[model samples]
Target: MTRSATARTRILNCTLTLSIILHAPLALAKTPVATGTGGAVATISEQASRSALAILDKGGNAIDAAVAAAATLGVTDPFSCGIGGGGFMVIYLAKDKRVITIDHRETAPAAFTPATFLENGKEIDFDTAVASGAAVGVPGTVRGWHEALERYGTMNFKQVLAPAIDVANQGFTVTDIFSRLTRENERKFQQFGTTSALYLRDGKALPAGTMLRNPGMAKAYREIAARGQRAFYTGPMARAIVDAVNRPPVAGGAGVRAGKMTLADLANYEARIRQPVASTYRGYALYGMPLPSSGGVTVAEALNILEGYDLKAMPRADAEHLYLEASRLAFADRNAYLADPEYVDAPVAGLLSKAFAAQRRTAIDPKRAAASVAAGDPYAYQEDQSIPLRPQARPLQKENAHTTHFTVSDKDGNVVSYTFTIESWGGSGIVVPGYGFLLNNEMTDFDFSGPRPNVPEAGKRPRSSMAPTIALKDGKPAFTIGSPGGSTIITTVLQTIVNHVDFGMPMDAAINAPRLSERNGAATSVEPGFAGSAQARALEAFGHTWEATPEEIGAANALVFNPDGTVTAVSEGRRHGVGSALVQRKGH
Candidate 1:
């Protein structure tokens, strides 16, 4: 961020803080807004945020705090994420002055084929596949946690896993979101005896404020803490996971399609260390997770396209229109060429090139939106021009607002931005019997009908839009941010950066603001705030089409590093029943 941008943010923060403090301290306490010196964390729940703060207070580093916080989310926010799922992590090691990424995205089992989700020659029912064992992949979160602590954390599983264990064993109050999600997945969850028993109270959603405890999850944590990640992949834990996937434990012994996962798929799973996706916007260095995740490239391409315009000087309506159009153009290419890199030879370098973005930008008109956006060819910008483009772009189906993201920062300048998920709320609707966590339906993320890029294959990871990202200013950590909104995740992160850098909103305000997501569709998905604003009316002259939805777009978590050596952490104040933010110290 520029110095002017930083100044504008601090001013807004101070003004907003005073207003909240003077008007509503009780309500303010419930909102996730914190600033301090030693460390900071922002997550989806107060319980998870405090768990991270407790670890930071014990002198644990940012990575350690992140793992501890994530584990707590598994207990309190079980519908979203846990050890049963997998995701991506972006970390900045202060000592190295470098950014790195851990791609722990779940991998398809070795028995998977291009037609794994197909019945006979036709694609299976999407809803049916989502709730069946066939949707489960070899979970990567357990191995991911182990790999993170082993490489960058100062503490071990025994120490970092303790807080989560406590939370699961002691129980936590069911918030509005937890109950709502339980109701949303009520039918699917009832199909599995173990899942229904844990989440449903007499086949009904638990009321808010009810104390829900998961002794099974706590026991699972204890086993992992005592024996480490290997035991989770090898022994009784492994057997339980496989049995759930293959036999499905349907209540009343009803039949369900079984998965092809075997003991070997679990044992062979490994977290990978890969190069971070590097890009630049407004002279600021941006680092994000690389492919098998389309988030980094798509968001980067959108930003790069926006950089073509002087948005800071444009009218609010014009800027918003440009933002929507840029997203549309970028997503066109994202849908076309991006997927699991191991399967598709994508032009990574070309997709991130400023030249490609500039070329795409030319297609946009300042006063009008294109009727339809088509994918652009980036091969011309590729260093290796010999590469050829693949078949026609195939659209992957994406849904689920149930994934979660969190950000952490330490006084040492180390930062971790992590986004994890189980695909949908109460994922696969099958919690391992006697184990408290839900299994992922991430396999359904793959395109159902496909012989194209992203088609399922043995050991191939599905493409994801989880973009855990960190930014640098003059070669040091500036901010760590991410969100959980399925495909909208890319738009949320991109717009947050644009708001902070170009629009000069403070970190909290940027996240709190309404959002618009245009993914090459005819209508842009717009939050109510923007839809009702005068700017939305003004955009009609530009041929912009808006599809307003009552649902909030994304629940983002972010931490901004101050030049004066302090950090500002923020989580959503209204979305997802409000989020949680905390810090080790209060002032500079």
Candidate 2:
């Protein structure tokens, strides 16, 4: 069958049924309260949410509260994001109507060789390359957060870190989500003494509401507060990391080689600042991740193409079909032309253009899915950009279960959308000693081939699917949102934008609404809970396939502003998170 027909059948039959099973009805997502405003924050953790509120109550700006809350989250919600990982920060300064993207992404070790992962001219399995030190990238989250605080925040690092110190020193109730993930990965933790000691209590993961403490993490926070990034990257913390990483693992084990990452790699790493990939569709300006991340450009292209249709008028299933087809076209382009701008040429400017979007949209069939769409030659459109195309052998599909994210907005109109991950649970099962966390297995995200040919090239950033985005209407900030779910991140953010901008749903409604995803022209997966029988059946008629799970959509945190000046915040129920609004009391 053609890719389009297959997608139509799969969506109508298989994927549709699965979505209904996963998504709870929309009514379940409603909150009792209506629109409210003042200063509010939504994140993936409760204690951290409370901490942000405390900062607001204490006269700290949103940036201050965000930094404080972020520190607290690192200690309390270690399963998702922490100091050990690196991510981007999108800051919106309402005063100047400016949005800045701080790209503190992790880079490969200097000693990394392009052909390091190849075995006898064949590419290595994704997991094998990732579990090795070859996967470790220089972490930049701490410095990135600190930079935001220093530049725009009112509170000091010490003050903001206090909340985290309290949580780590005294401990907080272990929530259900925390306990569940820990238990699921207990065996990996058990294999590493330090890992087991930190997360597992008496050979079992901490139960919900169990008081858990992390004095080590707190101490590490203190060092950062006092000495800044240097303390963590090269000081005692560095020594501790080297010591832990250098420890040889048990024979026939997954422990990475000791000292595979040298101090030089840590010292040479530098976070970058690049322009946010941007495009306009139906008058709304869309901004997303740039080169080194396939998310921003690909999402822009998808949105641009979808703009041609009146999604609101179409049935949810038909709209979904259109989205899947457009996503497939975008992903095909992503697999072909998207790469690190620093290492490889990327036709970003050409790809996000209106003309390019129109051309790509022509390949889409509103009635059926296009099973296969070849990537267009970006050079054909942009003369200045060109890269020789080389096809690499396809590797096995490896499912990765690791990702975390949070969004923060200060009263001053400073906003940050941060996403990070360990690539998998307990990343490589190697603890960085005193750092109290596992290193990311991001290397697995790359296609390991040969020396410089789709290989593990040192300093080359991997393609990330993380899509933390901010939307603007006529050049004004309208919404800020992001999610965790690997490939699912892109679809979730796109839907939230549509839910708010196109459907006029409230912040909570948009975030809590059902989500679906299509990667590289493959099957479209919907959160079973969101689709009804009619929509599901329609999708099958369109030839899209589905995989049912407990929830079709992953967690998303968001903030939105209406024309009336009311601000609303939201977080999904599926996550161990809370969304709070501190709107001025009515008639106050």
Per-candidate TM equals 0.94, 0.87
Off by over 4 Å in 2: 1-35, 123-132, 248-259, 383-401, 450-454, 528-532, 548-552, 575-588
Residue range with the least summed lDDT across 10 consecutive positions in model 2: 13-22
lDDT of 1 by residue, 199-254 (tens): 89898999999999999999999999999998789989999999999999898765
Q: What's the CA error at residue 519 for candidate 2, in Å?
A: 0.7
lDDT of 2 by residue, 1-588 (tens): 111222111111000000000001111223312234465556665567666766666777666776677677677667656776666666666677877777766676666666655568666554444444555666667777767777777778777888888888998888787898788767656766677778888768888988888888888888887887788789678766655554633224545543357777677667777778877767777677787766788788888888888998978778878887887777777776666778876777778876788898889888887676677655556666545654332321223434665666654566666666655655555566665656665655555643222245678776676776777886666777777666666777777777776677876777776666776535566665645566677788988776554243456777665677555566665543443333222111
**Could you tell me the C-alpha RMSD of candidate 1 in Å?**
7.1
What C-alpha RMSD separates each model from the true structure? 7.1, 6.6
Instruction: Report how far off residue 505 is in candidate 2 (Å).
Output: 2.8
